[model samples]
Target chain A: MPLNITLTDYGVGNLYSIRRSLENCGAEVTVVRDMKEVLDAECVVFPGVGAFDKTMEKLQPYREDIREKLLSGTPALGICIGMQIMYNSSAEGTTPGLGVFDGDVVPLVGKVIPHMGWNQVVSDDPLMDGVGDRNFYFAHSFRGNPSEDITIGTTEYEGTEIPTFFRKANTYGTQFHPEKSSTSGMAVLRNFISFAESVL
Target chain B: MLTKRIIPCLDVKDGKVVKGINFKGLRDVGYPPELAAAYEKQGADEITFLDITASLETRQTMLDIVSETAGKLFVPLTVGGGIRSVSDMRDALNAGADKVSVNSAAVKDPSIISECAESFGRQCVVVAIDGKRVDDHWEVFTHGGTKPTGIDAVEWAKKAEDLGAGEILLTSMDADGVKTGYDIPLTAAVADEVSIPVIASGGCGSKEHIYDVFAQTNASAALAASIFHYNECTVGEVKEYLRDRGIVVR
Candidate 1:
């Protein structure tokens, strides 16, 4: 049987790429609109790129529930703004995040603002295992600023290294858009599903 | 270090990819999905779909094409041409575009850039500026490079950055179909003025042209059409040339 992945849809941006990418990786994807249903999933995925406040609008109220589920060893993957909301606050918007991790989302330090394009990742974590190029597609101006040593991956931009992937138990967060990141990105989704299956 | 990007642009007219010479004399090539997939396989860092016939009537067709192509494309997909307002940007984004490139409309109302940045994130907003060299300075052009705006190319790039455009797609009108190489001086001026990543468009015939832009200026990506669409060389082959010449590519 295929592993069922519950994708949260708060109606901010297109959920097609991530949903379709997950399906391509051999998972039975179900995009759940309700916060209550999101908690009762085989695996959870917070995957998209949108404004922080707009994305956290419908998801803000259930912060405690989402955090609790993630903390209780739920295998989850967060990408871009999806990963940003795992922090305490974001400089991008006024809305408060779920605060799953002790951090804030701040602007990426560089001469260039968004740092849009492909960049090599520095990580030896199992999550990055088997990625052919080790280079992931990144298109964001801000990244998660974790307070502790939960950093699993880092990418360099103009002599500055930003913590891109943060890990806490079975939950993982990455600032890159894996779905739009070509084949190496597919390796990430494939690895995530396998990791989700093991934990579930 | 962040690797320089190599992008292949596909001009779509009513859902099918087309080829044209300097924005004139068009010809049908292939569907968006297959060509995009082929380029992606060839290690294209990103793919752009320019709606040459981006009229109000064919707007829905472009959106549908974006939806169809994005479903099968793995790398970042940028859709340009015909994005006049936030609603248009929203439609393209909702239809699965990773980024929306705004041209002529942005010149009329600069606030459109900020609005789109506010509605979506700045990362999804790309400002495409078409410029041509005239006398001693480059001039910004709109309406498919037919109508000339008195805006200075360098100043407009800086203004677009100030107005919250994430990236700039700087295309040189003088070099569109010439394909000798990218307009190095024109590209260098805007890219040096903007703090955001700039993708140099137009005037690329060989892999050497891509290398020239990256080595000659701060342009982050190089966008081409006829060179790659005609199968002169694959994007993978271009990367090999860049890598061998000491430029890092993913």
Candidate 2:
């Protein structure tokens, strides 16, 4: 049986890659434009695209409901800005985040503003099972800074360790776009599918 | 550590990938999605579609190609050429482009850079500078690299960054397609002048040329067309060559 995934489309950036990638991974993906649909999802995917505040444009109203659902272990996946919104707030935007995690999303301290391009990830989690030592593509200036306990993966850049992956309960958020990270990234998505299948 | 990138550029015209000699005498190669997918499998860090279509009538064809290709790419897809305004950028991004590159439109009015950056986060805005060495410094060229804007390439790069450009696609007209190597001094000057990452373009005939650009300059990535188009070398082969020479590539 295919795992039913509800992908949120808050009308920010393109969701083609994420939608296509999830479908290719053998999941029945449904992109819901209305933010409220996220609450009732069997499995939810919050894609990382667009500005932080603007990304919260639609979800701001239902922030509490969505947070409650996710915290109750609703099988949620957030990427980049999607992950940022799960925090209390972000330096990128003035709007308040969903507070799924107990920390704030902050700007990365580095010479290069946006840590663009591929970088190595260090994690022994199940998602990294077949990912091995392959690097993942990243393109963002800000990242979530929740406590180290929730951070399952970290990627070093210019001597600073940037948290790239977070997992708490049944929810997971990634700073890097697994959909755009090519084959190794696909491996992570595949693992997530298997995870959702097992959990379901 | 962030690994250096190798991007394969697909110059498309009228819906097909085309190869040419110094941006002229174009020849059709293949479909954009088909070619881009192959490059992705070959370990290309990213794929770029440089739409060289000449008329307004054919621009939609390129956008259609972008939509088709972007739907399949697992890697970041950047589209360039013929993009003029924020509306044009909207069309491309809405059609599924991750980032859009503006050239002549930006050189004519720098405000477009900030506007586009404002409209769609700066990370999605890329300013492409076609440069040619004259006397001691390089001058910016527009209109398909046929007309020189008399703007200093180094200064323009800095201004673009200041205006909120996320990255600079520096193409050296003097060394373009010559295959000797990237114009190291020119690339180094601009890269050093700007803090934002720069992608070195043109004059990449061999893997050694790829090595020279990365080893000598601070460019975050290097783009090539002919070398990978003619099967002279694959993105995988170049990466292997770079990896063997103690340079990190993805």
Candidate 3:
């Protein structure tokens, strides 16, 4: 049977691309704006773009439901700002995140603000299986500063090293957009789908 | 360090890839999605699709093609041509476009830039300026380089950045199709004036030309068409050439 995935649509960011990427991974995908549907999914993918404050506002109503599902050990994956929002809070705004993980999202201290383009990421996590030392597409101004224990990958930009991938329990997060990152990115998604399948 | 990007631009007319000299005399190349996939395999950092048709009927076709291409390609995809309003930008983004480049409409009303940037983050809005050298200064051209907007390219680029545009797609009309090289002076002027990323477009004939633009100007990326479409040089070849020359590329 095809893996069932529910993508949270906060009415912000690039939802269509995430949907397409998940569907390309041979998983049955559904975009849910309702909290009930989001909580009922076999697996959850929270993909986001735009400002952190705005995304938090849009996700406020479903915050409790999403946290409940994640805390209960439901398989979850967050992409880009989606991953940033999984932390306790963000420097992008005063708005609090879902607090699923123990960390704070902060702005990247580099010459370029939006570390846009493809960059090499190094990780030994299962989600990064087969995606060894490959470049992934990234377009964001903020970087997540998660606790050391959850950090799974890092990308060196200029002189600074930023966390690019992380996982805690059943929750997974990527600072780059795996949907837009090409072959290595697809491998990440496929791995996530496999993880979801095993849990199901 | 941030790597230099090599982007392949596909000019789509009625769902087919087309190329022209200085924005005229169009010729069919191939399917947009297929060409995009090939470029991605060739190691393209990004792909740009410009809907040259710019009509209501053709817009639907362009959306379908964007959706199809976004599904298969993994690099950043930027769509330009005939995008006028926030709703239109939303449609393109919803169809899976990573960035929307505004040209003629933005020249008519500059507010559209802030509107798009405000609604979809500054990163999503790319203001494409088709410029031509007239007398001593470069002037911004619109309507696919057919009409001159009488706006100074440098000043306009600064204004766009101040108004929240994340990047500027600077295309030199005079250098286009000639294939000598990019308009280094023009690209440098805009790149120096604006803090945002500048994509140098038009007049890329050889790998050396791309290198010269990156070496001479502060452009974050370089965009090409004819060379790639006609199989003169693959994206990987250009990248290898750049990498050999000490330029960082993914």
Candidate 4:
């Protein structure tokens, strides 16, 4: 059966584009704003934008439900701000995070803020194919410093080796929005969906 | 090592691709996504779409085109032409544009560059300086090279970098459609002033011009419109030519 992917539409994300892209790749997608709709899906995507504190506040009501879903081996993929919230603490917000990963979101210092545009990803996984040593689209200021075991790929800027993608069993996250990453980004979504389905 | 980039800049009108010479005789270039895919297949380093016709009616359509092309190209994409506010930048970035270039908008408010860089990161922000020789000094142009800003081109390029711009896309309005060659002096001037990468746009007619630009100027990359559009020079051919000239390109 095709994976039932729920892209949480918490009034923060540009979910339409992400949903449409996943649907095009033959995945069953549902745009959800409520916890009831979320539980019906096997794979959950926490795609968000804006301040980390604000995002965490908005997700507060559903945090317990999300935690429950994740601990049950339901795959959860976070994008951008969503990924930052997975870490223990984020400099962007005074409030704490979900503490799913042992890391913190820190600001890009000295160099320009909001490390936008495209940069090269140092990857050794199927999620990043055909990208080679080229550039992938990025738009963020704070980045996750994942523990060694969770980091899957990285992108460097000014000397900072930021973990671009992180994976720990059923929980996966990308500081860069793969949905917005052009073609190579699509391949990542495909990989995540496949990874979720094979979870036994 | 950094690879040479082949970029195709589309002049967009009401969300459709349009092209012309010397910013005149506007002609249709078909769908933006189709043109982007063609360029990507030809091994383009990136694609830039500029909404030439800056109008309220065209804004939504341009966003749609940006979203659509971003999906098909699968490489770095930059959108420009009518960006004004952070909201505009957000709209374009959300639509899948990897980077958004601001020309006229940045001139009106110099801090917009830093503001955008702060929100989206410096790498996502590009300051496109349209330069033209005015009385022996290169001056920045606004409104698609229709009006000239009093600021000196070289000075402005450095200021843009200082303001947190990740890269500079310098276009010589005088050489834009001339197809003679790049303004090596102006390119070198800006490239010399800034530590960041400079993309040399305008006045590229042949592979030799690319070699000359790289060999003569410190430009990180060379960008041409008509030459690449008309198949006058392919990126591989240009790179191979540059390589023979002892310029490092990957």
Candidate 5:
């Protein structure tokens, strides 16, 4: 059965291509721009771009709805900023996150603000099935410093290790965009969908 | 032990690969997917897709191509050109791109760099700057190098890093297609000013040039179009030569 994947669209996101990529992987993807569209979903994905503070403001009204969906045990994936919002607080903003993980979104210290290009990915999860230790593409200034148990994978920038992929319970998050990450990136997405299906 | 990177930049229009000389004399290269696959086979460390069309209609076509190529190629791919919003960056990334490169958009609204980096993470965002020599000073250009933005290259590079840009694809309009070599001096300047990885573009005529960019300049990677596309040399041969010169490569 095709897993029903709902990508939340809160006026700012990269959901359409994410939807297409999920569909390409044979998952039934629905781009849910409205809060209620998230009701019936096997997997829910939050795709975001821009500031943490701004995203929080846009999603505040739907906090209750998001919390309900998450508590229901539906698989959820957060990309980039969406992933950061799963934490407690971020250096980029004063707004609190979803509190799914006990951590904070901190900036990449020592190095420049935005850590760009193909940095390495140290895979340690079933979701990272075919990815190797080679450099995976990256672009972020801030990163989530989750607890050791939730840190699934990591990448280094200027000698400091940062979490590149995070997972906890049915909730998963990728600091890197699986959609734009090439073949290994696609493998991650496929694995996530597979996981979502098996658990469902 | 950082592996040296070799990136092949593809200029696209109407969803087809196109090649040009110094931003002129353009000719269709091939299909975007086919060319990406070839570059992947050639052992390109990464591939970049630049949308040459400056129209909304053409941008949609580029998205379709990105979806097609991302479905097939597994290597790291960077997509740029006409990307204005965070949503646009998300579109490229969701289409299976590893990074979204912004040129004019970032210059017009510098905050987009941080906005994108904050949302997508810095690793997935690249800022491409088209540069040209003016009165012995490097100046940033826009509109496919048709207009000058009057922004100093060195200053802008630092500002971009501050704005949360992960990497800077520095292309020299004057040196592009000329095959003289990468602008080592300019690359060195930018590399010295910023700590992030710098991908030097616009020149690269021979294997020695690759070595020169890394040795003479602090550039983390070197990118070229005509040299790799026209079969002047392969990435392996260049890496082998660079390795012999004591440069690390994967």
Candidate 6:
């Protein structure tokens, strides 16, 4: 049986692309906005693309519910700003994040405003299986500075080493868009699905 | 150190890949989704699909094509041609396009740029300027390079950036199909004028031309069509050539 993945749709981010990518991975994907649907899913994907404050506002009501699910070891993945929001806070806005992870999402020190395009990722985690040293697509101005213990993958831009992927127990997050990272990106998603399957 | 990008543009007309010489003489090539997937496999940084048909019915067809193609490929997909409003941009984004490039419509009402940018983040709005050399300066052209707007290309680029356009797609009509090279001076002027990323389009015959533009101008990315479509060189080959020439590419 396929994994029952519930992707949170708060009327932000590229829902179509993420939904399509998950479906392509053979998971039974359902986009949900209700709190109950989010808590009941076998796997939860919180994908985001927009201002931090607005996203936090949209997700405010579901915060405790999502936190409870994640604390119980539900497989959860956050992509891009979704990953950023998993942290305690972000410099992008004054709003506090879900605070599942003990860190901050801050602006990248790179010269470019939006580090948009593909870059190499170096990792040893099972999530990086078959990913190797291949480049994955990234398009964000902020970088997650999660504690080193949770960091599973890292990418260098300019002189700063930003955390690209992180995994702590069953909670996982990536700063890059695996859905937009081409073949290797698909591999990362597949690994996440496998993780979800293992829990099943 | 961000790497420069090499983008392959696939023009679709009535759901089939089409190539036009100097923005005219349209001819079918193949299925767009298959062509796009091949480019993705060949290591293209990004793929752009321009629906040349630009009609109501054709727009729906393009949306279906985008949904199918975007599902298969993981790279960024930018769709252009006949995107007139924020709702149109929303439709494209909902269909799975990462960015929406506005050309003729933006020229007519510059506010559309800010509106789209405000609706969707500026990162999703790309202002495509089709330019033709007029006297000493390049003038912006509309209606797929058929109508001269008399707007200075460089000035328009700056304005577009000010109006919240995250990127500019500058295509030189004069040297479009000639393929001698990119319009270096034009690209340089616009790139210098705007702080946002500028993608130099048209007249990319060889890898050296791509090198010339990147070396001589501040353009962040270079776009090509015929060369890739006709199998002159693969995207990997171009990136390899660029890397060998002391340019950084992913």
Candidate with maximal DockQ: 1
Off by over 4 Å in 1: B20-29
Deviation of model 3 at B100, angstroms: 0.3
lDDT string, candidate 6, B83-170, tens digits: 9988899999888899999999999999999998777777788999999998999999999899988899999998998898988999
- Candidate 5 matches the true fold with a TM-score of 0.79
* TM-score computed on alpha carbons, candidate 6: 0.91
Better model by DockQ, 5 or 6? 6
State each model's CA lDDT, in order.
Answer: 0.88, 0.88, 0.86, 0.75, 0.78, 0.85
What local lDDT does model 2 show for residue A39? 78
**Candidate 1 lDDT, A1-200, residue by residue in tens:** 99999998877678878988999999999988886787787788998667899888888778889888888898998898889998889998899998888889988888988878888888999988989878888988888999988899999889888888888878889888899888889999999999999888
Candidate 5 Cα outliers beyond 4 Å, as residue runs: A68-72, B1-5, B13-16, B20-29, B40-46, B50-128, B133-136, B139-151, B159-167, B195-197, B233-250
lDDT per residue (tens digit) for residues B1-250 in model 5: 3466888888887887678422212243478787777777666778899888848988778888887886667566789988989988887876767678999889999999998987866666788998898997999998788889999998998899888787889998888878899988889889899988899998778878888898888788898787777777777788788878898665
The digit string of per-residue lDDT tens for model 3 on B18-134 reads 774232123423778877887888889999999989899899999999999887787889999999898999999988899999988888889999999878888889999999999
Give the range where candidate 1 chain A is weakest over 10 consecutive residues by summed lDDT. A33-42
Better of 1 and 5 by TM-score: 1
- In the range B1-250, model 4's lDDT, one tens digit per residue, is 2345557677888766566423212243477787777776665667888888878788999999887876666566788878899889889888878778999989989999999877765767889999999897899998889997899999998899889887899999988888899999899998888876788998888888888888898776777767666666665677678768787554
> By DockQ thresholds, what CAPRI class is model 1?
high
Q: Each candidate's DockQ score against the native complex?
A: 0.84, 0.79, 0.58, 0.19, 0.21, 0.51
**Prediction 3 TM-score vs. true:** 0.92
Model 4 chain B lDDT-worst window of ten: B20-29
lDDT tens readout by residue for model 3, A26-137: 9999888775687688999988677787777867777877887897889999988889989999998888898888889987876555677888888777888888557888
For candidate 3 chain B, the 10 contiguous residues with the lowest summed lDDT are B20-29
TM-score head-to-head 2 vs 3, winner: 2
